[model samples]
Target: MAGSEGPLRLRDWLVAQIESGRYAGLSWEDADKTSFRVPWKHAAKLGYQAQQDAALFRAWAVYKGKHLEGTDKENPSVWKTRLRCALNKSADFCEVRERSQLDISNPYKVYRIISEGTQGPGTILPLEGQPGLVSKDEDKQSPSRLAQEGSLLPATLGPSPLADHGYQAPGPTHSWSSTLSEDFSNPDFWLHVRLFYGTALVHEATVRTAEGCCLSPRAIPANAAAEYLLGPQPRMARVHFPEPPPGAGALRHLLPHLERGVLLWVAPEGLFAKRRCRCRVYWRGPLAPHRARPNKLERERTCQLLDTRRFLAELCAHLRAGRPEPEYQIRLCFGEEYPGPPDQPEERLVMAYVEPIFARNLLLHSKRLGSETGP
Candidate 1:
């Protein structure tokens, strides 16, 4: 929703879009499937002008490598869906016609927009480079206004901007809540960890890392570690994971310990501990149900980066075979991210834990992590 805006009518936006398309080298029938997506530029521009949800229509960059805004998973760029929404409500002014009355006549599955004015509802706008079918109100514009509008047409995306701009596909029809505040510890909570590979690398690197990581075993040794390549330039390190004991079914569960995540914290400043010393919350299962406390006996129990990376590996596996809804989740506390390494550096460290809700939200901050947890 556009914050603080009054009520909206999809028809108004549709009228503006029709006008914008007319100004753009507008056409009715796309000569090929490739030409059909061209109108989305007008749809996106109108979205911005109307103060519509930026998530609904992410504008295309006129030049390469300029980051398009609004990159969250919430309300994905659905300009086409919005366009169809507006068109469905604007039947008096526009009509959608499949390329032919008989489906066999058109193999492309492309539909054309025809104006109510040109030849009633079925009248198509002239093909590109031909005279456009202007609406009655557009006749009021002076030649200079028309010229100014022409300069406003956006530069087209090539090599297909559909991938980044989302011009070709619709956002998913069903999803779960993006927020995570409530799911709690359960007997089944740690059955699987949700991992999100680092995001500091180029989008391509993110892809490679996730693909590379998803190949890990269903569960790793308690001390399992692997050398993963992190690159802006190559950076390598071995990260650790907890192995589930055998006979765990299609899923490998966390050991009875290490459930809510291995906590990385420091003793109170007056405790006379070493400089920058940190303490880990040992995985106290059901019997000793305390979150943080004075230590009892200890075993070499944790490595910080390893816990983070293990979650990453789980994410990859989830991609290959997880369902629409799974039993665990990955929670991301953006401003309240986990502390990474013993130094607990200056930037906030967001975390991904495998919980009752299987989430994959915090992959963006993983690459910057550079230290280890107390073992």
Candidate 2:
């Protein structure tokens, strides 16, 4: 009678009955019993309602599907087999069993449909004839479980405030360049970097060259540009490097023409080739003084290299201090400057940024080199 409205569908009426507290505290068995009492235009209408109720019950069972053990096992093995088969056939429409919150032993399984898409757990639905039906254990457990798991059960144990009207949870936040620049120190940003690069010594980094290429420690012909070969025996665009100025440090002396120079300790074989070697190079430099400050794109590239250096310097310091290395990836950027003609294209550099991959192997390699070299 409560759900009797003009042209209201049976499923909609059933949802309304539960929401209006007309059938509160009624188990599936009891709700089915009450549905029989609804007066209809004809017996066929009554039969149709029954059919709808049966279909709804089946859907509920499938959505809440989980393996039952002990006293909660309600169906025979054969019935469960048939149910599993039916659920498998309708997998896309039904909730995945692994993802469902319905515990096999939960007494509140009958109320799951009523609470579907509700607000956070611990919502109390007062049953019509049962005042103390909300169990004390459930009252304490729900909030604790929600806190521990960081998720809410859609519908279970009570009425959902979310289900009463059109309500939606806030969408997940997406990371963009601005967001990354603002919070480069956030663990999530580093996690994303690690995920993108996988577990390798070489990582993808910002390049100043028109043609992007990865840099590795290796010899280059004097006439050729220093860009690392993407593959064996094929020459690529050369990176520019002018002479370094006098009074520069020993590392800077290696490349006299570059500005804002820094030394990068590279494996003897470079960041590529698997063979063992020990070497260092003056790999990165800042923009020239006469040049304007880098635009947004260049700033991002510089920030990436700086962040990588910070991480690696920390790691190296930790290793030198004889402290246990923290479980994290170490990243680095290698750069080579290319001098351009004044009237033609401006000078640019190639920066090869590497992600933390095969980290333990690198650590072991470093240790072995240190031991052999007595450092």
What TM-score against the true fold does each predicted structure earn? 0.17, 0.16
Please provide, for model 1 over 1-375, each residue's C-alpha lDDT reduced to its tens digit, 9 standing for 90 to 100. 213653333433333433456423223354442213223332233333323333223332111112344553333233333333223222222232333231232112123333234332122334345354333221133221221233221122112111221111112222311221123222111122232222211011111111112112223322322211111111111112224336633223222222212222111100000001122222211112222322221212211111222232333333334522212232222223233345654232222232311112122111111122113
lDDT minimum window of 10 residues, candidate 2: 268-277
Residue 239, model 1: lDDT of 19
Stretches of model 1 off by over 4 angstroms after superposition: 1-8, 21-77, 89-94, 98-375
Assess candidate 2 and give its lDDT. 0.26
Q: List ranges where model 2 is wrong by over 4 Å.
A: 1-245, 255-353, 356-375
In TM-score terms, candidate 1 sits at 0.17
lDDT of 1 at 357: 14
Please, what is the whole-model Cα lDDT of each candidate in the order they appear?
Answer: 0.24, 0.26
- The Cα error of candidate 2 at residue 195, in Å, is 22
